[model samples]
Target: MRRLFCLIVLYLLIGGAPVVAADWSLAAYWAKNSPDRMIDILRGLNPEMRSSYLNAMALNYRFHQGRRIHWEVEAQLVRHHGMQDHWESNAVLVARWMDFPWDRWLDTRFAFGQGFSYAWEVPPLEPRSDPEDGESAQLLNYLLMELEFAPPAPDSQWSGMIRLHHRSGVFGTFSGVEGGSNFIGLGVRYRF
Candidate 1:
């Protein structure tokens, strides 16, 4: 099943026309179970070290364009706490507000994705049997808000980003699981 998903993503990235750009990034993050609600989680600024840590690598392919919106597909591999952990693949839609006064210094974008994740083992911090209180391995969702710093030159191929990474089940979407996980990550993005 994983092989099939990878093949599909490869096909979409290579065979599809109109895809003009792609980016790859590597990030390290710390994740923990938050007692706070989703909105509260979003409001907090500090990283919590209550659980474990992971490293992630992601490939993003931009395939579509609209007047104010763009679309991309992202495939990510996450190594939880230095162990082979999980794989998450998603189709993401992004919107950037280019008119921000800070554009000369950085770019701001908001992205949302819905996808599936496969875990080598049940997530260490999330409870398994009680779906109403935790998460599931079969399906998941992602949310991100990123600030991409401008490079030294206009044509520079590399940039840095501070991102808020979030994964959740969306309140019983996956067998009644509601809560999930959050990570604050810093990474560099290389455009190809």
Candidate 2:
């Protein structure tokens, strides 16, 4: 009986070890709800050129199944100068690298993802007035690095994130066709 009790206790001890799972959070934009600001600006300068910037934030749920891989779904919006607002959605698979912490309150991460977007534009009063840029659907590739403040309180649930993101495919098929935007953002996150 003594031996059996000892074995049971040993099993309990090993099985009850705390497992640290990769926490996930909802990410939001600091300034705008959509990614269309820069594209709108570009269009304003030259309506003949196809320019669009769409802004988005995603609710990321990460699972630590070996390495850190993130699955994200984002709802985004796009607006161009003299154009109607458009909505877009994306699903991204991201790879994440967690940098060494600085002190006790900061955590930095680098992530990359490739995604696609769809847009429906409101036809201009004079379709010929705004020449079609030719490109309809495009691919988006991005690199993002975020510095986050993770306070050591309430089980480290609250955080503030500062992120820099570079987005491509902002320009349509015509007129050189390649462009992107630089975004500096600040927002809050709640990790679960």
Candidate 3:
């Protein structure tokens, strides 16, 4: 009888298993004001590289339709006139929240989490008594909203999305209006 019960349990587990493949998505984004503030801070150091101010980024993510957790990363490459160049990158941990009512034909999600980042600011052509440029690793926070084409489901029946995110100042060191940098972007998600 014990052997029969063990066999039954194994059968149930095998029968309920579904084979699924991991999927990925890529998004192109353009935004203003973000990292703009950082540029604002950097400009004070060297006013020459003002026009070279450009902000563009790509977002990448992997998802498991069976689980609601996802990971994301963003990089901002900005050029300045001095030896001190800067790259801001963050690795984010995101969780999709329950759907809520929006307008017609759309669903909403709230994803909030934090990440670890590396930041480097180059020094001026000529060093001052105090060089404001340095490298640091810090903590970051993100609060985002995703608006998708279809209703929320375990497998997302059919959906595309626009994700908006804001990050906090590297851990608790710098203070800004609540929420980190702000991003509003669009993309699609397909699940098998």
Candidate 4:
């Protein structure tokens, strides 16, 4: 399983290299930990938060552009501070929605992506959901959901973004682990 994961990542990077030279984007965010499960947090059930925090920067390359749907791959580097101090990295494939009815007022895009996440150490907050069965690993599955907004001008290259950064075991697929950790983040994106 691990070998397959490595090969998939290599293929993405190598196959997308040519497109990387054409146009690329940069994104950065400041994220804070949420103690509850991702869905519960999204449903607004959590009131308390964890002490963990991170700042992440990602370089994105868009290889396929359609009329309304676009495809991209991004590589990220992260620095966790506050309650957890560690380095993390990931590479993801993203599908973005670029068409909206209100484009003249505010250009909006929503994106969802999934890939692999690696930690320099076992992240302190990523305790296994079922403590009796599993433990956190230095590598796990990564997922992200982002909403971005920019000005109406076609020449605009800057935007504001909000995202949910998640690392999970995919129901014990990565290891014996289950649900992992989540962070709610605010950030910016620049396209060039």
Candidate 5:
């Protein structure tokens, strides 16, 4: 899986179609201890959930253009804190809407993606059983809303963003279990 992800990124960097611009970012996030239904959150239904201390690192690339819609590819690695902990790898392609006008210093975007994920073991969940039903084959879906702060100067290469990362199985695509995960993240992006 790691080899496949590396190859995909290498291709993107060296052989992908030309784009007006591209941005790369690296981020770390903490998963919520109790999972929430994505629909509920999107519908303005907020729930109280605790932090799980599960840490994750995400690497992303955004293919930029002048249009409102753009594309992004992301790869993530997740790890837990205990000795019994395991790692999970997720890769996804996102379609994004980048039209929101927040301010002169910020750019706002919303996106959703579908892809596949693999875990050494089924992620332990609270208040719900394994959505994959102990099977490793899982469909991954994500919703991301991000705020990118503009660079300090016109030609600067550095910027920052805060993002909400929501991951789920989309109501049991594998079986009949409605389960998923969420994280709030901060990242630094470099544009070239």
Candidate 6:
């Protein structure tokens, strides 16, 4: 708990160095659980589907808007069901890339976020993915990678997204737990 607080304070200290045109957004997504690790999933390995699913909604505050890069903080409320039933929440700081060469053809964006995730209860399926580590925590490190696109119009407010939702212990940083869970999610976003 102390470590998490310290990290958040440090991140806020750095982020507070600048304030720009702030904006807000709302997003929602539905994700299915995968039996593969985040690395393998990103490497194009086929996902082994599980019955677990999560529906999530997020509110994003973009605090900085640079020409090529933007910074945002996001809060998510997620509901989990299927193989298990519970609730999870996440707070993340995201970095978004705004300028793509082919924007005139099809507008595209990529964003990466890192932060913390807290579950209503320790997830049972998490330890099964890493039997050797056999430890799961209610609170863990969270991360996401999202790619979204819209029409060629620069003023478009709606876009579709495919995101990778991941949670991990970061080599025992949380509770001497080495592994966690991953979800392949599809969603949409509306920026206002």
Minimum summed lDDT over a 10-residue window in model 6 is located at 12-21
Spell out the clash pairs found in candidate 4: none
Q: What lDDT score goes with residue 66 in model 6?
A: 57
Candidate 1 Cα outliers beyond 4 Å, as residue runs? 1-36, 82-99, 128-135
For candidate 6, list the clashing residue pairs, or say none.
none
Give every collision pair in model 2.
Answer: 34-55, 35-53, 35-54, 35-55, 36-53, 39-53
Q: What are the models' TM-scores?
A: 0.68, 0.50, 0.42, 0.86, 0.66, 0.87
Error of 2 at 19 (Å): 8.5
Assess the local accuracy of residue 55 in candidate 5 as a C-alpha lDDT between 0 and 100.
Answer: 70
Cα error, candidate 3, residue 119 (Å): 3.6
Deviating ranges (above 4 Å) for candidate 3: 1-19, 34-59, 66-86, 98-104, 107-109, 122-145, 150-163, 170-192
Superposition TM-score, candidate 5 onto the true structure:
0.66
Per-candidate Cα RMSD to the true structure, in Å, reads: 9.4, 12.4, 11.5, 7.3, 9.2, 6.8
Whole-model lDDT values for every prediction: 0.56, 0.47, 0.41, 0.87, 0.59, 0.88
Reference-based lDDT, residue 137, model 4? 92
lDDT of 2 by residue, 161-190 (tens): 766544445454322324443444577777
Q: On residues 11-100, what C-alpha lDDT tens digit does candidate 5 reach at each position?
A: 553453547555776766654443555555556545556545467777878764335666788888877653326677778786666555
Cα lDDT tens digits, model 1, 1-192, are: 999999876654344345455443333333434434557657776534444555667677666643334566667776666322554443344443223455566654445555555555656554534544755554566666666665445676666766666666777676666766666667777766
Global lDDT of model 2:
0.47
lDDT for 147 in candidate 6 is: 95
Candidate scoring better on TM-score of 3 and 5: 5
Model 2 ranges with Cα > 4 A deviation: 1-23, 31-55, 65-84, 101-103, 120-139, 170-176
Q: Choose 1 or 3, whichever is better by TM-score.
A: 1
Of the two candidates 4 and 6, the one with more favorable TM-score, higher being better, is 6
lDDT of 5 at 190: 62
What's the best-to-worst order under lDDT?
A: 6, 4, 5, 1, 2, 3
Query: Residue 87 lDDT in model 4?
Result: 98
